[model samples]
Target: MIIGLYFWNLLRNQQSNKTAVDRESKKEMEKLRKLRSIQLTQPLAEKTRPQSMKDIIGQKEGLKALKAALCGPNPQHVLIYGPPGVGKTAAARVVLEQAKQHASSPFLQDAKFVEIDATTARFDERGIADPLIGSVHDPIYQGAGALGVAGVPQPKQGAVTKAHGGVLFIDEIGELHPVQMNKLLKVLEDRKVFLESSYYHEEDTNIPRYIHDIFQNGLPADFRLVGATTRTPDEIPPAIRSRCMEIYFKPLLPDEIAEIAQSAIAKLGMPESPEAVRVVVNYASNGREAVNMIQLAAGLAITEGRDRLRAEDIEWVVNSSQISPRPQKKVPKEQKIGYINGLAVHGPNIGTLLEIEVTSMSAEKPGAGKLTITGAVDEEEMGGGARTLRRKSMARSSVENVCTVLRQIGLNPFHYDIHLNFPGGVPIDGPSAGIAIACAITSSIRRVPVHPRLAMTGEVSIHGRVKPVGGVVAKVEAALQAGVEKVLIPRDNWQEMFAGLQGIEVIPVDTVEEVICHAFPEWAESISERGESEGNWIDPSIEPAVQPILPFMQARSTSE
Candidate 1:
């Protein structure tokens, strides 16, 4: 009876121990659930991630292209090109969700969207670990866990397989490694990913049936690819580009930035003043940047116990961050000789007004004249990894080109030594400066003021033709921001001009004489008042100025 009592006690203790273990596991899981439910503080940018297409700003055309490419029954692989923070990733994410709702879309209800950053996606050389493409794990890493195939190889699916029948998004796809990109192209073509393992024997019965089948018939990777890159189209490999339909997103304008900042403030449950929003717009270059600024400013306002976001808080944030405001090159009202507003593109798409000025004084002796160039680099760039940064400067060559054009138009560059200066010490380089350079020099020579509401960008030929130049859209944007009312682009560019442009007149000029007639409005007006056909394009409006250079002009013209 004593032995029986001892056995009963032992059984009771074992039951108690098992109960304690169950309670411990339950407690741990409850704690885990609680932790999971606890929401951590997220950045304002993350908090405002676009859940719908409407939430994304300044990317209408890009989003439309994305939808058409993915929402159709026959979806195509896509490559999205744009500058950073301009809604490339946001568009990619939101488009897939919307595409799933389309009746004709191929994506099923349970279709997945797998995203990986080519910049961060880990890649291995020996097929040990490739998150982008499928890799295999030899028995050594598995520690021989599978039944019957304890010492055999196991196939591991990567993002490609996981995203099967859906979309695989790769941000910064241009940064993908060469080997992986090749493998990706192969998978894209075959719609399947083949795996290999040196340790596996197909005839071995120990191998899992699934593994054998995977080896025999590759895993299904019949998914669509959606790639986002901050790189230009040319930077991407032709092989990858050929397989995908390309889309471009333009840089965000200041107004769009303001809109985003205001929306972010509203989302943060903060009232925003227009000035405060403007401050954010001035500092923020894109949507992500705008939200980031509003977030910090809102926090600072809360710390100061202000219910509404104030410009002071924004100023504080800007000052604390040491962030420089966008360059405010307001158009100058006063007319001045030897200075003209020339348009030049800076970075990817940001355009700036260049101040090209020329101060001409007759050389100490005739025929000893020289053109001095400054603040312009060699118009050179470096290329590697199939990338090119084109930088061209008409600093010297275009100036020389202008000199030739000037001679043809009856301006004696040799009689007067010209000192052309592109002020602000900013490196100014492009293929050409419009006849604006010639006008500035002519302005200095004739002491006539060029129009205040004008900006121009185009290449000039030696024979006086206004040839086409790139970035006409960006140039016009810069012109508008500077409060300029008119811009002169190459006539050859009329077909490419941006439509729906309000508050600015885009004049397409064919020859230097046309630029002369338009820019020297005084001359144009004088000619118009007299009602003379295109005879002499010289400025008869330069008072007292015509005398100093009239002799040189007549002499040069008569001689030529």
Candidate 2:
């Protein structure tokens, strides 16, 4: 009877232990449920991420190319080029959806989309850990458990392996380490990744069958790679460029920004004034920026108890966030001598207008004139292997070229003390501003006014010839944005692409004489009527644009 009682106590203790464990598990799951229930609303940008190709805005040709490259049985690897917030990532993701729908597509319903950010991807250089290329964990690693004691290596799949039979996206691909990039290239070539470890042996009985198989045959990585970068095509390595189909997405225009802003507002169920959206577009450079500005401004409106977001709210957000509007230069109504508009490009594809202005005075000592230029870069350092070479600014060189052109055209530059300024701190990268400088200097010397709406981009030679410059499309776009009525490009640079561009006349000039004829048509006509060579000193008969300051000085003296 005592033995039976002892057995009963043992059975009771086991039941109690089991119940305790069940209760503990139940409590933990309840806590998990509570944590999961606590959630916040989705961010405006997240909620508005493009779900399909149709939802992507501002990239018609880009989307077409993306479709052509991806939506086929044999999808080509792709590289998308554009600035941030221009839908490159979204287009990549959505294109895969279409690609998977094709009847002949090899991708299955369960195929995954793996993403790795080159800038943020962490890796161990010792083959211990790599998030992009699969790494083999040695037996001595912490997570190997009993395997560590047995000295077996474990292979960890990376994005490339996880992306097998699917798509692998690398954002900011140009930022990848050279070694990782090479490894990626190898995977692309072999359609597999071979993970290696010093501790690994293919014919070890202690290793698991899976490990042996992994060592024998590499992990499958037969997936298409879609890389997105903000860099220009030239910045990316040509080896990768050769392997992938290249696609370009233009910067988001103002109208596209407005559309993105409006869509975000609707998604948020927040009311906004028309001017408020216009303010966002004017200040925000792209779609993502537009959404962020809207969300912040919307929150500000709610805090202020206003029913709708106003332009003032957006302005406050812009100022507080230090967001500057896209550089804008309106065509002035009144014509001014020595004022010329030069076109330039920003980054890969943004165009901005540079206002070139010049003022000249008779030298205090004849033939000892000073040429003072403000806001033009005077010096720069060119970087190369283990050396820094100080070079004169391209802008400064262009000025020297302009002075030489002046002599070639029979105008003596040494007689005048010239102050050439690029007002508004416009960004000028190269000698593309040469023609503008020449035009401004000539107008100042000859007292001829340039057309107020004229904007020109070309490199000027000492012989007064206009030479071809890069970024013609972007430069022309900038001119169009500024309401420029006329644009002068180099004759050799002209192509049929600029033919149908409306709202601006793109005139190509071979020489500075033609530039003068177009920029100063009235003055050119007078000179032609007199029947003189296009190249001559400003007629001694014409007056300089400078007016005496004596009247203002006398008035000041009387007031004093």
Tens-digit per-residue lDDT, 259-364, candidate 1: 8888888888876689898888788777877777788888887877887988888888888988887676777899999889998866555577888888888888
lDDT of each: 0.81, 0.84
- Compose the digit string of candidate 2's lDDT tens values, residues 424-445: 8554458999989988998897
Which lDDT value does model 1 have at 287?
84
Which sections of candidate 1 miss by over 4 Å? 1-34, 140-144, 147-149, 379-395, 424-426, 432-434, 496-500, 524-560
Q: How far is candidate 2 from the true structure (C-alpha RMSD, Å)?
A: 8.3
Provide TM-scores for the models: 0.82, 0.85
